[model samples]
Target: MSINWDDLKVALAIVRHGTLSAAARALGTTQPTVSRRLDALERSLQAKLFDREAGGLRPTALVLALVGGLEQMDAGAFSIQRQVAARDTGLSGEILVTSLDWLGDDVIAPMLARFGAAHPGVQIELINGTRVFNLARGEADLAFRFGSFEQENLIERRVGEVAYALYASTEYLQQHGTPDVGDGFEGHRLVYLDRAAGEVPHEAWLPALARHARIVLRSNGLRAHMAAVRDGVAMAVLPCLLADREPRLRRVALPHPAPVRWVRVGFHSDMRDTPRIRALVDHVVGEFELLGACLNPKQ
Candidate 1:
């Protein structure tokens, strides 16, 4: 059976927002219009997509099963629109790319400069943050993610690998001496990523330096933590890609270099063939190849 796009959009919006009024607000329409469209959609499908409960309209199993297909269809429609726009304007459009803040600065920024130089007509918008951007929800057109992803109907390529190492300021190293497995870490303060503190990995890894080391400072930002190290606030474990580039920092000891993590560039499978997206992927892959030694050092 043929489904109207508008009705499908309304139905999906309602399911997402949990209430007709919220969906209406999202769609910039009245609650009655949203309710009417959802009713029409249910009538056309001859299925109950949601159940009215005390909490709100809860999506049924049928809705969950169908939502994936509907989302795929929506992605396809957007791909078509993007293709048409690119064709009409000759690749002169904006592409949104998301990545971790430090990676964006240390890795993606240079590649973006080269890409921009080559494709002057194309505009690139980079969103750098610690939060993972939802590609399925169209939060970003492309993402450079670290670690593994198992999302279906998406294209993921292992672009590179990153290694972490313990680092400290030259001044701190001189004052406190190098820490080893038996060293009394309690003698020196520790700097850690605020997001990683109390995390099992961090707890297991950092404490390996010493049994009684205290975390004196924590920051949610890699750059900030590295800066703290440079400023002689405390020593921190940092990605080698960033540490190796800093002039004032020195590698202290292996202590607990977390396992290397894979860096992946991901995009919707349908968008893989788009010229602009393909060009970007190729450029990033090439850039990583050129800089792999720096990002994933032998040590």
Candidate 2:
């Protein structure tokens, strides 16, 4: 009897996540489908594979016995898939990339346009959001991100650094006369990211600025914050790559410079040799190299 790999994948997901709904979510299907597949797989094998428990489904001895072998099979299958992709010298396939919303419009869009022009056959799906797409779950093929890399067993490279600085409209700077370091922002109207946005690590520089400055507005995105600054509503801390070119904005010379964070590109290590992924990674590295000075002006 031949075992179906797709059914085995469903079984593996159930074992990994411990519930039909969770398995269905992981596999991008419905709970009823997972249940039907599990039932069918058990009937084909003529054995009970799991015991429904209060906590969740517990794998029976039969399923436990199959886990190790199935995991190895899964890894082998992934390796083979990667090998096939690597062998495709024609470099034709869809590549999904995850990027922050702020970079989606100006920075990554232009670079991706250039990459798309060269690889006319390859399609790209760019997911731009505040949420981090899960690479381990096959959510995205490539990512352009800020700060540090956390996921293990992925190929990660620091492309550049993004420097954050306080900026105000030239009209506001002229009217407010650019608050001095000694004055400590007492008279300044500051626009900043909302603390409730749960961006504490990224906003570590803001507390000090907020202590003395009057927080006039709070926004969840850089674009909104920058717009507030441009409208003469308040001064804002913004990424230099985006704010520097805005002729209406001027950088404030503070006693201490703004914080700079590293920007990184990462993908699953297994896909390192995959032709399209490697080409995109190399293109991203080259794009960063060309604009490294602008991204990390201080360095």
State TM-scores per candidate: 0.72, 0.80
Give the candidate number with the greatest TM-score: 2
Looking at model 1, the pairs that clash are 194-219
- Candidate 2 per-residue C-alpha lDDT over 97-185 given as tens digits, one digit per residue, 9 for 90 to 100: 88898876678878887998999988888888887876755668788887566876678887666677778899998888787656567
**Model 1 has how many clashing residue pairs?**
1
**Predicted model with the maximum lDDT:** 2
On residues 234-282, what C-alpha lDDT tens digit does candidate 1 reach at each position? 8887877778878998877563445466679987665766677878888
- Positional deviation of residue 265's Cα in model 2 after best superposition, in angstroms: 1.4
Give the per-residue Cα lDDT of candidate 2 at 85. Answer: 51
Worst 10 residues of 2 by lDDT: 81-90
Residue 104, candidate 2: Cα error in Å is 3.6
TM-score of 2: 0.80
At residue 40, candidate 2 shows an lDDT of 87
